[model samples]
Every structure is written in C-alpha cells, then in structure tokens.
Target chain A: MKEISFKNDILPLGDKLYRLALRITCNKQEAEDVVQDTLIKLWEGREKLKEVDNLTVYAMTVCRNQALDHNAKHENKNISLEDSGVDGFDNQHMPDERLIYNQRYEIINELINRMPEKQRTVIQLRDIEGRNYQEISLMMNISLADVKVTLFRARQQLKEQLKKQKNGL
Target chain B: MDYKYIEQLLERYWQCETTLEEEQILHSFFKQHDVPEHLQQYADLFSYESEAAQECLSDDFKQRMLDMVDEEPAVEAKTIKFVSRITPLFKAAAVVAIALTIGNVAERTMQDNSVGDNAGAPSIADTYTRTEDITATIHIIDRNQSESMAKADTVQVDDITRR
Candidate 1:
C-alpha cells in the first residue's frame, strides 16, 4: 500500500473543505475553523484512512458535517436570543437596501447564502467545485437523484433572483 | 453569431439538463464582455461560480495546521517513550537501594555486636571467670589429679577414698 502523506494528500483538500464550509456556514472564521477541525480529524485518523476509497470525498463530508454543526449551533444561539426577547438582534442574512443597489454579484451571493443548506452545498459542489453528481452524492451522503434535485432547486432559485434583480434594476 | 446556442444552454442550465461541458461553454460565453444584453443577468451567477472556486484559505492557515499537527503528539510521545524506556532502570535502582538498605542494616547489627563485645575480649573474660568458679568448686585439682581423672574417666577414686 502506498503511504499517505498529510502534506501531499490531505493538506491540499483544505481549500475545497474551506469552500464547502464557507458555503454552509456563511462565515469565513467559522468555515476556517471547520476546515481546521476536519483536517485535524483526518490527520488523527490517518491510520484508518487506508481502507477509505476516497479520502478527498471523505474529508469534504467531514468538513461539511462540521460546518453544518456550527451553523446549527449558531442558529440555536440566535433562537435563544429571540426567545429571551432581545431587542435589536439584527438578522445577519438580511441585506441592506444599499447592497441591492451595489454590484449584481453581491446580490447573487446574498441569494445563494439564503438558500437551504442542502441546496447551497449542492450548488457549491456541483457548479463551483466542478464535482460530478456522483461525487456530490458521495460527499453529502445523499442519493444521486437528491443531488440533482437540490441543485436544480438552487439554480431555479438563482434564476428567480436574477429575474427579480433585473426587474428591480 | 446567433445567441441561440447560449440561450438554449441557459435554458437547459436552469432546468438542470446541461452537461458539465455545456455548462463550461455557458460560463465561458458569459465571461466575455460581448455577452448579449438580453442574457446579461445570468452572467454574474456563472462568473460567481468561477470566482468562488478560486476562494482559498489564507497563506498562514496551512502553516498553522501543520504546526498544530506537528507539535502535539511529538511532545507526548517523547515524554511517554522517555518514561517507558527508563522504567526498568528505575526498578533496578530501587532493587539495588533495597538490597543496600538490608545489607546496611545487617552490617550495622553485626558491627554493633562486634563493637559491644570488643571482638571476643569479653568472652575471654567470661571464660576465665567460669574457669575460676570451677577451680574454687573443685579446690584446685592438680595436673596429676586431672590426668588421673582423665584416665579414670567417670570413676572418681578420690571421691571414693574420701567417702
């Protein structure tokens, strides 16, 4: 069996993991943390990774899970604040009116960020990451059909947003 | 140059029917500044995809990760190996210490006896005192009498004559 070098084999997956995490978490710091945690996990379990068929996909899956967990915790924190009747707790996803008047790309970014986690991740993996449906399915642990469906919904959402942006413009 | 192909690809793209290559064609078509005004709205989405893929971790992140992985277990392994490697030597030292303690105790006891007795000097005096007691009890048996006693063994002729 060929030896797996962390620097060669695993570290290169950091950016992919970061993109997935950032797509899921919508925060750079949280995404970086998720990637760091995922890499450390892969390094710690490198001994058992020999049996893994696709280490890259496995790392992405782990990063995705960690990112989702962070998002869940963050939402829960926000929910708790809401429950406590905290006033002026601004919503992070709500874009200001000026951002709508800014570059079209920011609006697209905002729209992508507002989608469901599965849809956002599916778009990130399929379109941005250039991953096939099979690989996306494997990374997300979803069926192939589900990956396409999620991606279709995501793309359709973007189309609707583009239409709305055009009308607004 | 008809915009029909891109328009069709964009339609298929929205329907999730475009192949990856077809999608790349659309992305490339949109990247150019000559994008027809009618198809311009979709360009940002494709361009975003292209640019977002370029997003990467900072330069120091990889170094930080390497540092984290490299530092921890090495220190732990060094400490563990050092202890494991020297444990037997420690046990051997403990055994030698116990043996030396027991030897010191035994030697001290022996020395105490030797010092108190002055190396058998008191035993010689004790023997002399015992001999004197016996001489007084037997009233100074001469050498001839001792020889006669030895020859006669248990028969005491002197005692019989006195009787």
Candidate 2:
C-alpha cells in the first residue's frame, strides 16, 4: 500500500475533530487550538498510526483529550454564551420567527450549558454529531452503558426543560 | 409517516430504552417540513441537533495547522514502538519478576485452597518452572482452579446462609 500523506489522509479529519473539540471545549477558538494540537500530536505519532485501522476514531480520541486539557486550563472563560448559537441556525425564518427562534434556542443552549460536562458532551456527540454509542464511549473513555445513561439524562432533562418552557411553567 | 410509532419511540427514548435506529427515526420524523401541530413543540430540539451539526472549523484552520506542523522539529516524528521503549534487558527482568510473583501467589493460594477444601491435603503449589521459560499450564490451572472453587463457594454460601 502507498504511504498516507498528512494533507490527504490526516488533515481531512479537521472538521470532524473540530466538531468534537468544540463539543468538548464549548469555545470555538480553544476548540480550534485543541484540534491543531491534536493533529500535530497525531503527526508526531504518525509512525504508530500507520498500524491503526481507524484513524478517524484515533484522531477523535486525541482531540477529546486535548480539548479537555484546554478546557481545564482555560476554564472556558473565552466562551461568550451569546455568540455560540448565532451561526448554529440559518436565517431562513421570517423576521418575527427568527426572533422567537433565537429566544427558544438560547434557552435550550443555556439548559444544555448548565448540564454536567459529561452529559452535555454525550448529547452533542449522539444528538448533534450523530455518533454511535460505542464511538461516544471510546471518545469519552467511558463504558457503553455509561454513554447511554449520560445521553438519556441529557435528553430527559432537555425534554423536561423544553416542556416547562412551552407551558411557561 | 405514522406519528404514533414516532410517539412510542420518543417515549422509549425518554426511558433510555430506545435503540440508536429508533432515535434516528425520531429525528427524521421531526425533520419533515410540516410536523403535526401537537408534535411541533419538539421540532425545535431535534432540528437544533441537525442544524448544530453544520458547525465546522473556519477555512483558515487547515493552513494554520499545516504551518505549525512544518515548524516542528523533523526529529520529533520518530517511530518508537511501545515495546521497544523498554530495553530488552529490562523486558527480560520484568518477565522474570512477573513470573516469580505469579508463581509465588499461586503457591500461596493453592495452599489456602488445599487447606480450605480438603483439610487433610497439604498444598503442593509446585507447578512453576524454575528456568526463565514459563509453562502456560502453570497459570491456566491456577486460574481455572480459583474460578471454579470461587463459583462453587458462592453458590453454597448463598444456599445455606439464608436457612
């Protein structure tokens, strides 16, 4: 087999790794930094990765660790909760609908941000990124059962919070 | 799409019993343009997941990383296998130490099992090899003996203790 190029085989994973980092770190700039560190670390360990069958998962695990490290050192203070969801939704709604959408989305984001880091990260991976439970478990360094339980708690909390909002309770 | 099945899946979902496929089905169901009015309230949450996935690193991220990668020392990327990291001398020493420890532990456990099980038989615990070369049966017999004995003791202890 031909040797894998860093730009082709490795760098293309940037977006996926960035999503994972952003999910873990919750700060875009720090997430970007984490992805950069993760990619560089992988490149340094490239010789070892040649034997790895699934580089994407390997890169994800690396990204997760770096993101968590960045999260600890930074305390996520760089995050402005207001700006997080601005780019999350497209501007296809009517002017009034857009305002309502922003309000509802901000509430949901606050609820999600208030969640324990593990539960929120699990929700992001499973719900937003559409990763399987096994992959989430590996990325989080937790068991499969733990992944499901965390996700269930996140979803249940989201449902309850959303329902309360709907009822204005 | 049948809304009833999706409702059931949503229920199972809240219960943490829904399979991944069922969860996907719920997302897809809510993705439809005209979600039934009753279910419309949930449309935002599921759609949020879909929309949020669109977030990606900026275009400049790749170039920044590539530049950083180029600046790093070329010698840093050397391939050092995990096994190769430890000197062969240390590896041999580790192998011997582990074997000796396992053998010693096995001897003690065998002695305990013999005393505990038969009361009359002395634990021989002599299945270990003295040379650096180790026999597989030595470990296997100890593990099997311990496992089966533990299982038997568990069943008996539970059966009689309640009475």
**What are the per-residue Cα lDDT tens digits for candidate 2 across B1-163?**
5678878888888887877787788888877888987777788888777766776777787887777777543444443444466678798999999999999999999788867746544344433334333556667778999999999999999999988
Sliding window of 10 residues with minimal summed lDDT for model 2 chain B = B124-133
State the lDDT of candidate 1 residue by residue for B72-147, as single tens digits: 5575579779999999999999999999999999999998978878666566457556766878657655766888
Scored against the true structure, residue B158 in model 1 reaches a CA lDDT of 68
DockQ of each: 0.54, 0.36
CA shift at A23, candidate 1, in angstroms? 0.6
TM-score of chain A by itself in each prediction: 0.82, 0.83
Best by lDDT: 1
lDDT by candidate, in order shown: 0.81, 0.77
DockQ of candidate 2 is 0.36
For candidate 1 chain A, the 10 contiguous residues with the lowest summed lDDT are A80-89
TM-score of chain B of 1: 0.44
